[model samples]
Target: MTELNILHHSSYPPESNGHGGSKRTAQVLELLVTNGYDYTSVDFDTIKALKTLKWQKKVSLFLGTLLRFPFKGKNISFKRLKRVDRLKFISKAFIAELSSIPDIYIWESTLDIHQFIAAELKAKGSKIIGIAHNLESLVPCASQFGAIVHHKSPINRFAQELETLSICDEIFVISREEQWLLNLFNIGAKYLPYYPIIETRNNLLEIRKRRALRQKNNEFLILGTVLNPPTLNGTIELIKMVSEVSPANAIIHIVGYGTERLKPHLTGYSQFQLHGGVDRSALEDILAKIDAVVLNQPYTTGSLTRIPEMLIAGIPVICNEAAARSFYNYSGVYLFSNEHELTDFLSNPMDTPLIPKEERVYTDLFIKTLKLAV
Candidate 1:
């Protein structure tokens, strides 16, 4: 039996659950578990290695030179923590956890943790795999020189990200566009589908049965994070803009965490409703109600996870050009370069049409990815 320990970045606490990362992690675990591949994950508290070394070492942690403390990453606050203490903490916690996991898969759960895991995995002669969804790009889009510093850096936070990519036996990105960029850096990679939750619903048949019940119509819609807060600038600014331009009866539902921000400002807005952070079941059920999806995140290269969910649910999607390049929304996604194009598409959205839903499959790509690392 081949045991695979995944060093994943967990957005939500393990028990609290309901986080996208939790969903993703659970899905990967399900695939591996159902297929009989051994798997396990680390809890946030298990990150105590960071707590111990950060305060004690006073020097940066992990990898030969790249995992330095107080890294000047795109997030300025993290830059303040960029001290040797924080780096040491992160390195210790990360390395210790990686020590426990068996055969490893370094998924895009966090940009911060990847390097530490990669460093150890390489040293142990263990199989190491890297998975990248758009989460890797969110932090980069917020600051000045964000892209330049992170992607094309001589001395930057992404040095760790870059190091991890170099160290990992194989790197996997969600989009063809991301894979294209990695190739430029001489990093070999493959493309894979990003998912919302670990497909635990054993009711795949029931899921399709329900979706079939919904009215599959012509005119589509654009909805997203009415529940989750916009961690990336492209998404926040996008919501404000879309609300102003979309049609009177646009059938849009902005679902996720930070609806309160929009609620105070856009009161009584017709055509859309912000359902802040609903239960996962409620969120999943609503997909049938939406005509399409839109993610205007301008910063990153690959597409967001929501885009993938919309596609699997059989909805057409609208997105900025950067987003279009990131995910392979093939039959559904209508791509745009700037606000004007986005507005033009919103005004006249016959550009791209929706497609039928397909029962999603993932393990094959994952197994292949792991093999590359091995």
Candidate 2:
């Protein structure tokens, strides 16, 4: 059989599971390799390259900013120049690794930088497939205390996102809502549910057995980087609800990168424990001890991977409607619309049986989508 030449690109290396974005990218890469596709991977060293502004780039950026000030105002001009530099760098990085353009190019994320690279690759006669982890435009604006969070203006972000997606031959979205939104814009999008890297059936059964044994004190888990706006917002709301409703014996464990930043908000809540950025083994150990996971996101954007991860582990997930958007039908997921509802569920949490089915459904769907797109 002749191998299909596929190229995957992302801002972060697919092997890195330090964050949700990387984990999602890794899942796609794994699927490609497992399906026997001959693929090339290119990633922008986000931390070392794209994020860092060297003196030379700074000077170029300043000059470029001044040059475009007459046409686009200083602030917009500066943002545009910086974006161009990042896009140029990404295109150059991918080209340096390319011996020949692959038959298909799959770029990750909805960021303008990735779109720019995708457009460039498409120009070179390669089929372009975009993996939109989240529609950045749909992510709600956030604020801390009284200060507005710094980010691209929503209008500009939405415009850029539309332009980026318009160039794609096909797009893979993480949630049904996102797919619907894209369809409204006449963009051909496919809903690809997240495929979590989970333990074997035997291991999951063991986890279910452990979960079935009711402890004297209920333990709940909330997993996400607190630095993220949506998570931070949801966590604060959860803390308030749990504090008011949870019994003195209950414990809420918060784990993820930047969770330590929640210290100030958690001051008087002794029931909440923050475990900042634990490894896979550590997370598994924690999962074994927890009865349920809580996801109280105020607004929906991308599908949260933790939903599937928890369900696959046989752990119950108590989430708000927004957090449970794409996962409504998944086994072991319970949705709450208000604090009263959340309290009721926590008092007598539902049992989440182990999901023994392999992720072949996701794999088959992904392969089918690729074939149609190609």
Candidate 3:
């Protein structure tokens, strides 16, 4: 029996909204648990306790590097703890508890701190599988040279990410675009399709019922996080385009985190409604009233998990060509390029029939992705 050790940054409480990396981490664990993997999950946030605290039972404390420690620890600040000291503590505690490495180790994000630890684990006959959630190499100064392939010297966080991944037996990404970009750098990786959390209570029957109620209004909506530069700038640009072409009667609903940033931009537009972070039930209620959902992420690097969720709602989705990288071939996705194209479609939209809920099988994709990873 092959044992699996899953490593991640933090814990996702059931009620947590789970934005960004947290969401991906939760999804990965859920899939592994659901598929009957004899797995152990080690969260790094609480890993430091393993050092000073004495324990009878073997507790796992695994840390992924990319997780940002914003605040000071109880006794010592994260920055104050030297890297060498931290590494030693983790190494000693892990060896004392586990005695031997597991058959397989699936690391959530590759960080330089993990390289030495992972190398040692590999030596103990463990297969290191890295989930490259985002391409660090493309993150400008933060990562590597980004899209600059012919740079004289490549360095920074991206170098560490590449070095760590190179040591891994296999690598997986959530976006086709990322897979292509990684391949360009001569790195071998597989594209794993993203799977949204589908609940029986909020099933396809309910989604279609919501969509039916929504379609009668013929309203447009663009929703997600606007805190980041890519999403914030993209949402602003999309709004500007819509303002130029959309009819005076058109009602556009903007929801999710950082929507307050859009208030200044929509001064003249009475049709635009901004709903900042709301409860899950309230969000669903808003989605139920939205006719068509627009995804305008021109600078999105990794997979947009929200797209799959929107599709599952049985609503017509209008997004840019670049934003549709993940689902370009999916029959239900509607693609457009510029403001002219989007405005034209909005003016006299064609009949985009609701896709059967059964066809949107996220679990099937998850199963297929897991098989390819191992």
Candidate 4:
């Protein structure tokens, strides 16, 4: 078979597992590479120096920012102007780097920046495939959970999202809820749920075996990058819940980047161990020792990627309704809406049934969707 030249673009390095978005992009790339596709991955920095902005565009952006200052505040207006300029630069760089029009162009995330690049690629007759990590417009919903979300206009944001997504030939959504919403807007969207890569799956199984050998220590793990506003807010709320319920003999293990921000709140709690960001090996070691994983997200715009990881590892997941949106029916998932319920689950944890490795069919489906799209 003749190799098809494909171009994959992302804002972040797909190889990095620092966050959910990167992990998802890595997974998609893994599928494409293993399926025998000739692909080139490009990020913002890849062609940064190849493109330069004209003085007219710069002046226009400055004037626009100045005009919005009184209405949107100086900081927000300037930030918006800066973001627009960056996107414009990236789009120009992307087009300049293209030696020839690719057979397929896969852009990660339907953010305005990616959309700008997608529009440029589409004009060149390349099949545009967009990966929508989340409905960007719904991100402001985080504010309900005490997360600070800055947006000039929700209605405008929503319209922009629709416009961006509509330009793509096909969209891969991380959750079914998002797919549904996009379809409502007459966009061609497919649900491609997250699944651990083969290596990660095997490692998780090994961790499960190690966990089974040790006696339960009542150690529960909460995973997320604490630097994220929603995660930080959720972690704080979970801590408050744990303090209120005060589950006996429970040791809450918090792991992720920027967890030290939680230290001030953990002064009196000796049971709380904050392992701020660990290497993969260290994280697997921690996973092997924990009895269960906790997800206490008060509000979520996208499905939590950690849910599938814990479920596949046969580790019990204690989460609330909002956190357990997609995997509610999965075995070993315990839901709690109030302090009393959370206390009961923590005090009397149940054994989680191991999910068979073969049950992970999403990976195949994800690859199939891409194949069909092309």
Which candidate has the highest lDDT of all? Answer: 4
On residues 58-140, what C-alpha lDDT tens digit does candidate 2 reach at each position?
A: 68766875776577543444555556655676576656557787778887855754566677778888788888888876677
Off by over 4 Å in 1: 3-20, 44-114, 135-140, 143-160, 195-222, 226-245, 249-251, 264-268, 284-286, 326-329, 335-365, 369-374
Query: lDDT by residue for model 1 over 220-287, one digit each (tens)?
Result: 34344433333345556775777776665565566666554566644666666667667767766766
- Arranged by lDDT, best first: 4, 2, 3, 1
lDDT for each of the candidates? 0.54, 0.73, 0.63, 0.74
Worst 10 residues of 4 by lDDT: 140-149
Q: Please give each candidate's TM-score.
A: 0.67, 0.85, 0.76, 0.86
Q: In model 3, which runs have C-alpha deviations exceeding 4 angstroms?
A: 1-17, 45-92, 113-116, 139-160, 200-205, 213-216, 350-374
Q: Candidate 3, clashing residue pairs?
A: 143-158
Write model 4 residue lDDT over 1-374, tens digit each, in one string: 22677888776666445588777877788778777766887656557453465778678767765775676553244555566655666676778877887878887756764566778788888888888777767664433121112445776667767877788887788887788877888997877777667777777788777777766778888788876677788888998888767567778888888988988988888778888888988888888877788878866577887888787777889999888877787788899999999988777757865573443366676566557655
Which residue pairs come into collision in candidate 4?
none
- Candidates 2 and 4: which is better by TM-score? 4
Best by TM-score: 4
Candidate 1, poorest ten consecutive residues by summed lDDT: 141-150
